[model samples]
Structures are given as C-alpha cells and as structure tokens.
Target: MSSKTGLLVITNPKQIGLVLSSVQQKVSKILYIQLLNALSDSASGVHTKIFSSIPKYSKEINGIYTQAARHCKHLDVRVLLSGMKHNLTKIKTQNPIDIVIFDKVFSQTEIDSFLSGKISTLTNNYKILTLNNTSEQNSEELVPEVSSEEEKRTFKHGVIGGTFDRLHIAHKLLLSELALRTDSKVTIGITDENMIQSKVLHELIQDLSTRIENVRNFISDICPDLQYDIVPISDPFGPSIVDPTMDMLIVSRETLRGGHKVNEVRDSKNLPKLYIHSVELIDEPERDPAEEVKISSSTMRMRLLGTLLKPVEINKNIPSKPYVIGLTGGIASGKSGVSHWLQELGGLIIDADKIAHGIYKCGKPCYDLLIQKFGEDIVGKDGEIDRKKLGAIVFKDRNELEKLNNTVWPEMLTEILKIVRNATEDVVVVDAAILLQAEWQHYCHEVWTTLVPKEEAVKRLVERNQLSEEQALLRIQAQPTNSSYAAAANVVFCTLWHKEYTRQQVQRAWNLLRERMCEDVLANCKNC
Candidate 1:
C-alpha cells in the first residue's frame, strides 16, 4: 500500500491508548497525535503543558508494540504530539496530512467545525474518519478516566540520557515522557566517546551529531516551543549530576539505576534531588531470543543488514554484467575472511594478490619490469623473482615500494579487468588490498571495505602471525587507517568479534547486491 501521512485526534486525553489497534493497521508514513483538551483554558492558558499530557497517553499505547509484534518494527517511532486547540493550522502548515482520525468522543458537529476551518486547517478534500456517531449522546458514557495528581503535574526542568542511535520507538517514548513532565527545558545527554564502546554493532551507530540532531528534531516536532540543550556525554552521569536546576529525571527500566545515582550525587552536592520517573521497557516480541526484551538501537543497526547504506554511482564506461565489488582493508583487518564469505555467497572472487603474484612469475608481464627496477640480483635460483628477498629490499624503503607498485600495478589492473569482464558469475568481488591507494575504484560498480580498531588489528597480527608488538605495530602503521577505507567504501565489515558476525555482514551485503542487480536489470529493460 502507498504510504499515507495520518493525524489521530483524541478528545479525551486519557483514552490515547485505546486506539493502538487502529494505529497498527495504519500504513501512514508518519502518524501525528493531537490532543484537544491539552490546554485546560481556551482563552487564558500555558500552552506548553500539552507535551506532558502526551506521555500520559503514550503510557496507554506503550503496549501497542507488543501487540503489533515485529509487524510494526519499522513503524515510524518519531511520533509527533501536540495540543490540538491552538496548533491545528500550525500542524497542517508543517505536514501534508492525508487523513484525520478522531476518537469516539468527538460529536459530528465538532468534527465538522474542525474541518470547516474553525480550528483544523485540514481541507475538505482530505478524508476524515470519525469513531463517533451522531445518534449517540455522551451524557454519561464518554467520561474519560480522571488523571492522577502526578499526571496533572509539570516540572521546571527534566533530564534524560541515552545513546539514542537510530532513534527507535523506545527512545521516542522516553523522550516524550521527558517533554511531558518538563515545563521549560529538556536537557538531553547523548552517550558517546567511551560510553558507546561497549555496544554491539556500535560502529554502525549514527555519529554523535546525527543522534543529537534527531533527538532535537523529534522534541521540536512534538513540543517545538520548549528548549532542548543537547550535549555529548562520556561519563555515566553528565549534566544530570551537575545541573542543580534540573527538577526531574526521566529514565527507562534499564537506566532506572542511573537515575537514582543522579539523585545520590545531587544529595551529596546539596542540590535538590530530582523526582525520578521510570518507564517500562518496550516489548519487541519478534527479536532474537538472545537480545534484550526492548527495542534497541543495536537491534536496529543489526537490521541494516541486506539494505543499502550508501548510494552507488554507476560507471557507464564499465560493463554491468558481473557487478564488481572492490573489497579492501588494512593489514590483518580480516579482508581475506570477508572475501571468503563473499565467495561462498556466489561472488566470483578475483584476488588482486593472486593476479599480482601471477604477474611476478616468469614470462608474465611484470617479471622483466621487476628485474629491471629492483635489479637482476633479486631473481630467485628457479628463474623467478624471489618474493622474500624482494620484500626485504623494498620493505626497508617507502620510495622502493612506490617504484615497485608503479611498475606492477598497471599490469595487475589490466589482468584483473580481463578476468572480471569475462566472468560468468552475476557478482564479482575484486579483492584488492590497495584498491583505493592505487585509485582502482573507478572501474567497479561499488566498493566494500573492511576495518577494525587500529589496536585491535595490531593485536590480531601479533596473535596470528606470532609477531612481536613492535613488528605488528610497524606493519599496521604501514597501511591505510580505518577512516580511509570507510571513506572509499559503500559497505563496511568488521571481524573483530566471532566469525559468525563476519558471515552475517557478508550475507547482508550479498543479499542487498542481488536486489540492486535485479532492479538494475528492470531499469535497463524499461530503457530499451
């Protein structure tokens, strides 16, 4: 079904949870919830308090994810909430809402007045679905549940902390609760630096700026008038432990302990203890049994498998029959391991090292050039260049290595292209170690890179090659950094964990590449 942008209206704020069933069935790209009675006063009112009212309703709908299970996993969780009394025109101006849904409490006349430009800015051209009937009277049946004193209360300032990666529904619910209770300011401490070091698939997490921007955007969408001071935090307790002005702390079940710790630190500082409010963990019933019970950024990052992470630029000069994936990484960074996975997944592995080795043999194109450049003394006793002896000569000098690369790389590239152009496999992996360094990505469809932490790469080299720490360090520093590989890559893999994780990353890349190739075929057919 085509995506529709929808707006849900609830006359009684207490019944917000009652419409999760309806929401689950909605294919809307985004669903905005607007509360009619958020402002108690029509003429004289503090309008910002409506944000707090949303969290009360959010609690009612918290079970929706459990109900939808994995079906609503991709449901846009940046749910926008606003006070409907004054913001109807403002919302319509911001979004092109396709449908308006009302709870059973709204009268037909009330909806009519809303559509006829009395309060709602929605045009009559828009489809309107109402749960209310004209024949039904609300004399006694439609009384909403009375909100508790806590629900009715609002605070001066509220603080919350999280990684906020991918910004899933759980993150949204927590942020909504923070905006709900806090009146003036919402201080968000986004976990980064040393804090993100422990997360699984942490490399895939959006950067600190992106997370902060998304959080700020979500809050601005739901409660635009309120102030949000976003900061990158390295420690467990950031501004919450230090900001004496904060009066409330919003936390999930996971961070409930951290919230109390914030209070404990505040007590020591002689600052007012924040009122700690903890929300339940969101249930993700379809997730792997091994993962946590809640919807998480790490799970979302894992789900990025078999999906396009970056755009691929089609090189028209190159033939598309065997789609080439140029794979590269630093020394001991598991490029070979990833290549093995791709080969098993049906990609024709064109090993650049093998091609270069072939060129170094007798009668091959680079055999004479190797002797001419590095001297005939480098030749082995068996009429071929001795690789170990040549390595000793070139390894001591960067300029000598450059001279050798300049002599051999062109011949190797020509041989690789010849193999690729004639291959029958639907996908081709040009496993080149210096793909980017030699400026070889120009011929391929897209590049896949592998990387590991610099220190981790050194550790792997020491353990696997039985090299000393100093020797491993020298070899690692000789190659390109992770940043360089990532910059040149369309997809990235890390084998720092078990081989199973490496297989998953490679499998995801293979599946997505197949899908992309199929689409390319269809496009070519249409063009014909």
Candidate 2:
C-alpha cells in the first residue's frame, strides 16, 4: 500500500509458473519458502514479475502489470514472455517484443550463428547496447535478464526508471526537474539494450559495470536522498505494467515513442497503457543563423576527421586548421572542465551550450515559438524566458516537451551546422553531452563522457552550488544516473579522483585523437 520500489527481476518460464501458483495459493511450505528465497536473492521490490512458460502464469502477470499501470499514473509495468535467442533474425516480421528479448543477451558467437543461418539473414543496422563482463564476479553480476534458476522477490519503496546509456546533461536535467516536481521517492530502470535499436549506432563503448557505476555515481551525487535501484526490464512497457507500488514512469522523447508503440501493442491485447511522466527535450544552445548543421557524437567524430564541416569561429584559435574534439560527460560530470582545459591549451571550444544559448537569446525564433506554445506565463518580467518554469512544465509532462521540441530541433540543427561550416580553429571541441542520443555520433571526430565518483559529484554540487541537501540532490537527479551513454561515446574520463587526474586522462585521450585526426587528414589529402 505504501510506495513500492521498482525492481527488474528475471526468471525462467517454468519457475515463474510454480512461483505464481505458490503465491496465489498462499502456500507457506517448502515451495513457497524456495520462491521467497529466490526473489530476495535476485531482485528486490514490488516491481517484480515472473518470466516463465505456462500460459496461465503469463496471463496472471500481464493482468497484474496492466491493472497497476491503469490505477496509478506514477507507475508502469509489463512482462516479456516470448522470444528465445535463436529467433532474433525473424524479429522484424515476428513479434517485435519477442525479438528484442532474444537479442538483448545474444553473444557474439550467437549473433554469428544467427547471421549464418539458412534463412539468409541480414544484420539489423540498428546498434543494440552491449556489456561484456571481464571477471567472474562481473559475469555473475552482469547476467543477462533471463534466468532458468530463479530468485526471491522482495519489494522496496520509491521507483524511477530510464534508458541511461550515455548519462548526459539532458538526462540529469530531467532528473533534477523531476525531483523538484514530486514529493514521492524515486527508482529507475536502465532500459534493456535489446529494446533500443537505431539504424545509425555501431560501437558499444563502456560495458555494464561502467554504465551501472556511472548511474550509481551520478545518482549518489545528485539525488542522494532518493532511494535508487537499477531495475532491469526487457522493454520499457513491462515494468510499468506489473510494478504494483510504482507511482510513475519517467520518459523522454525517444523513450516516449517506444512506450507509445508498446501501448499500441498492449491495446491490441486489450490492455491499458502505462502511466508515464515525460521529460522535455533539453534544447542545445543554438548557433548562428548562418550555421545550419546539427551537433552530435557522430557529427563530432566526422568533423574531427576533416570529413565534416567546422563550427562558426571554431577554427580561429589554433596553430593550424581547427581540430574538433567531441566532448561529452554524464549529467553534472564536469564537461566544462574538460572544455576549459582544451581552451587553455589554445584550442577553440565550439560550445554546444553557448550555441544553444545564442539560439534562445533575445529576438531569436525559439523565443517566439515558446511564447506561442507555452504562452508568456513562462517568460520572466524582464521579457526574458524563465528557464526554471519552462523546464518544470516540459520535464514533468511528456506531451508538452514534445510540442516544444518539434518546433525547435529543425531550426536548432540548421543553426548549429552553419557554425560548423564557418569554423576555422586548430582544435575545436564540440561540447555536447547527448551527441549520441541525438544520433549525432557520425559527426564527431571522437566522443567522450565525463566519468566521476558519485560521492565526489554529490559533494561538489552541494558545496559549489551552495544548495541544501535536497536541492543539490535534485540537481544530480537531473542527469543520467549511469554510463548507459557509453554505448554512444568513444571514450570516457573517470573523474572520481582529483581534477588533475581528470586532466591527465583528457591529455592522453587528446593525444590519441590527434594522431587519428592526422591520419584522417592525410587520407583525405590523397583522395583529393
């Protein structure tokens, strides 16, 4: 009856059926004891469900999550039942949910087998997030979501969830936004990589430990008061359906689209949709009107190789033609420090935030657009936009943020590109946290995430911002809780230690990037 902790638990179909039967029947003997033990050991919280074989178990679990989603606007849940690993090739044509479950944990060897099967299968260009365990302990910790051997299920209170691969500023910004908007505690889900597939993604950077650690660190630093857990679900739809005590599900534009699709599927089954709390898109600062290209991890990578255009004024500071480095970090991970270092070295910092700031300055089109959509209420007395009020409205509610972004992204991208084209600096850093999430990785010469200790980050925010425990907690909540963003980044800078250590890491990375850039330039010269 109290708020429940959202936990992602995995189990084999047969085991799930037995466990459900035992729970429903009020069996208190050996079978029930074993079930309890299993649940407690593997997962904790009311957001627990069985991944089993029996048709009856599936029906019961589905009904529970669906009912939860309907009664509580704060909670969302669903169950992943079908799709074995070998069936991935047929994912597009078969059930989409089933396909995702299959691929979520496929090994390289399994993938090869699928590719070589007689069906003449083609690899989906979409990049699924992946984590490779290096140690035995890690292997056990990073076990794929499916389990033939089950664990006990115990429910905790307070739940929040998100797909936080490359924990960026936008993500943290939203989390911070949420903590401010709600009085309830929070829990989160790191969207299973299987469900997230994009045509453009390629490399899988920073494994699960890094991603989890990033999330742990970010949350510990930003929102220490809120109880947090890494809930594991095969798809966004599942946890929202079954998690009984969950009050709400956090969503962004990308995830919203996925959740909507999930709802459509659920509706076909005559089920209700999950209650979702949508976060608004954090608009990257705009560039000059003449600058039209978008900023992204991909674009940043391309720019670094001289295969893409430079930003406005980015080419002016260096010894030779500008060398653009894609700089990114987890929410509140001190990307500014890295950018400052690059600037101190006489390199140009083609700041995404600054460009975004330029876009929203007085007399810009974004201002007019915001006024039209959200009205003048969000504007301050000085005729300037009120960021806090606007953020509150957008991040707490999904539809509003979508409307805001639809108007801004096109124009924002155009302006950003123009800046890139006119840039002429020797070393320009495209400082964007969501370069990958924005599908901008193709443009980056290389992408990096600011890695920091969650404890240190918490201390820094509390000290630097002069915020109360709760306020600083909210700020950290506003970013990515983990390194899920690593899937999209090429490199990461661990900032848990001292600032000097961070600088040293950056220096080494910059040196390597420099060599790669030189090679790329030479190759281009030959082609010319």
Candidate 3:
C-alpha cells in the first residue's frame, strides 16, 4: 500500500546509514536491503559463470541473489559480472520481475543511459538512484531500508560519510528529523581529498575550516547529541560497518550501491553483513511550486555571472553570510550621527548602547548584577535605571568604572558575537563609542570615525542637549580620549557645523565601503 511509504533507493552503499540517520528510522524494519549482481548461469539461472570459479564469491553471490529472487522473482540484476557489461535491457531476457534494478559501475555513459531511458522498465512508479560516477566498471547501487515507527523507539548507532560541502539548513532539517525518529547517536564521517577526488565546482564558497565550523555550529545548535567529524571515507564500506560494535551503516540514495561493492569485499573477508539504511528523496527546491525555480550554489554563480537574468531563491532559513563594519568616535564626537547615516545607507547598526538598553530591559540579570556590585543606590524608584546616578558612581572611581565594564562587558560581548556570527546582511556597522576600549577592534576589518575639536564638541553638547558647559566637559571627559581612537581609524571625518558638508562626507565614505565589500566578495570568489 502507498508504494511502500518508506524510501526505496539504489546508489553507493556508503550513504546508507546517512539516509537512515537522516530519516531517524531503523534499517531492518524498513526493507533495508542492498542491490547486488551475482554471476548466475546467465539470466536463465542455468550454470554458474565467472563467480562460480571462485568458491567463496560464487557461494555468497548465489546465496544473496537466491534469497532476493525467492521473494522477488520479478527483480532483474544487470550483467555487471560480465566484462562487457551493458544496461539491464541490453542483456537477453532472464528472470521475469516486477522491477529490474540495473547495476553498473560508476561511469558517465551508464548515468547517461539510465537518465535517458535507454535502461528500460523505469516509470514514475519505479525509480533509479545512483552515486558519483567514476570509471565504467565502478558503479554500484545499494537499496535502502524502508523506515518504520517500530524501529524508532529502539536506540541505534550508525556511522556515515560524505564531503558535506557548504553546510545549509536542509542538512540540519534532515539530521534533526532523523534524531527525532530514533534514540540514536549519528556519527558523521566526512571525506577529504586524500580519501576521494576533490569536488571542483565553479562557485567555491568556503574554505575547509569555514565549512567544518559551519557543520559543527549546525550540529551544536540543532542536534548536539549527534557526533560528527572530518575523516577518511575511501573504503567502499566504512571501517565502522565491519566492526562488531557498530550497528547499521547510514547513507543517502546516491551512496547505496557503493555498499553492494563493499559487500563483495566483505564476502572475501568473511565479515558479517552490516544493516543498511537509506534516506528518502529530498525533493530539490527547483521542483517547488511556490518557488518559480529552485536555487543552488551553482545557480547563484550563474546569477553573479549575469548568465541567468533572475536570482534563484536560495534557502533563506539557513544563517546568512557574515558582514560587519566597525564604527568608532571619541567623546562628544559625532559617532551617533555617522551611525545614523550608516543605517540610512542600509547597513545593520549594532550599537553597544542598544545592547546595554536591552540588558537593562531584560532586567534581572543586569539589575541583580548591578545592585550586588554597586549597592542599592543604582536602582531607581520607577523600576528603571537612573542613568545619571549610575554614571556618577562609575565615572568618579576608576575601580568602580572598571568593575562596571567587567560586569557588563561579558554579557554585552556575548550578545554582539551572537549577532555577528549569524549576520546575513550585505554590510553591518558595529557602533561602539569605546570600541578600542572594549577590544572590539579585533572583530572588525575597517574602522570609521567622526572628529570634532574638544571645544566645538563641548559647544554642540551644551547647545543641543541643554547641558551647562561644565556638565558637557564632564560628559566629554567620561568617554575614551580622542587620541586613543585615532590609532584604530581607517577612515576619519571632521564633523562640521554645516550639515550639508557633513552629509556629503558620510555619503562618500559609505560609497567607498560598498566598493570595498564588493571587492572582497570578488577576491573570495577568485581564491575559491
């Protein structure tokens, strides 16, 4: 019923457990079987051919095929045993089966044949899935087990491998769903160039460290219990599958057939069979009805090249690319004015003051922390912070100020780092008056500053804020001195009384920043 609700896949064997781990279902309960080719007396099952000459290989192949045929007489195994192996249809008729799964080593010709319908008997009702093609005789297809509810309750341990290029939300979604189904820990083994051929694509996005970091962050954020690593995955079957302690081998449809070849090797070694699990077909986003067309990294590159007129919709759910710019200015300077300009320019402004305000609003953690460190005087009557009172206490005493910085800096940095880590915006501005003081310089690539003479700044404060000249001076003194911030400035603007001139200066700086960002993107692409 329902054409078997669980997935039926034929591909490289290595991805079986990954598929099972993805779906979070058990291997045995879901028809977890491997597709294999055995040398029978030629389709008629008359006499044993090449395999018969080798007693062990002959027995194992015969046994597995015999078992599969007894239950599935309609199944057809392509003649992979012959040196001149051809498509399943190319061979003379042998066994009459409901579905014939053709097995060919990984090869471009074989892939073309299957996809082109040259390999017959395929319909919407029956499908063929495969792994990366290598040589003509290297193709392998492994059938996945149909995952079921009963298998999920029991804890299962599995190991799987992959290249895992550019981690995305789809991967997290697939992993989380699998974890939900089984009480199991999925240990991921990733492949590197040493174990396999390098995957070369035009849009090389991230470096190895960035890719691994993305994978680790995804695992920690979404499925902390799942184990993962960058490891070798060359053997047709992973080393874990042969180990007695390991249970099932997890994989995707693309890797199922590789498992069959592994079985052939295992038969030679007399190793016990390892259960296989395959992941269900994840419909490509291109096929989505809501999305006019699916988008991929390849598609993004096409858009960048202007080969494609419209941008494909890349999955927005995953974290966006990192973008950050450092904005700093001295006491009574026009940093806030510059920050506002950056906002108008469509830059994400992460002001330290805003974070502090949030902490004060979140209440307890910051409130309790302040009171405990500075005594009850810091708390106000209306259940809000009296900024003047708090400022007075800390501004006067260096130890008090240091203590305040110590108390607030950790929490502030934590929040800022989280935002920076997940930034997807084209450009983000880190508006920190005390950026140099707070050690935020290391996090930024460029610094923009606003400069005004101490006397002029003081005059502006008195006139605009209605503060007395002496009060303005005190506020100015409270900020990090101008010389301290100058050391870190990559671009500096002299704030003038004329609003038009100041605006022009800001607009020029923004245009320069945009140019720099585009250059950096282009540089990264070239390196990739």
**Whole-model Cα lDDT of every candidate shown, in order:** 0.72, 0.47, 0.50
Ten-residue region with minimum lDDT total, candidate 1: 43-52
Q: What's model 1's lDDT at 508?
A: 82
Ranking by lDDT: 1, 3, 2
Cα error of candidate 1 at position 262, Å: 4.4
lDDT of 1 at 309: 71
Off by over 4 Å in 3: 1-321
**Separate clash counts for every candidate:** 1, 106, 36
Best by TM-score: 1
C-alpha RMSD by candidate, in order: 5.5, 21.3, 21.7
> In candidate 2, what residue range of length 10 has the lowest lDDT sum?
28-37
Candidate 2 global Cα RMSD: 21.3
Which pairs of residues clash in candidate 1, taking residues 3 or more apart in a chain or in different chains? 52-180
**lDDT-superior candidate, 1 or 2:** 1
Structural similarity to truth (TM-score) of each candidate:
0.78, 0.39, 0.39
Stretches of candidate 2 off by over 4 Å are 1-323, 466-481, 524-528
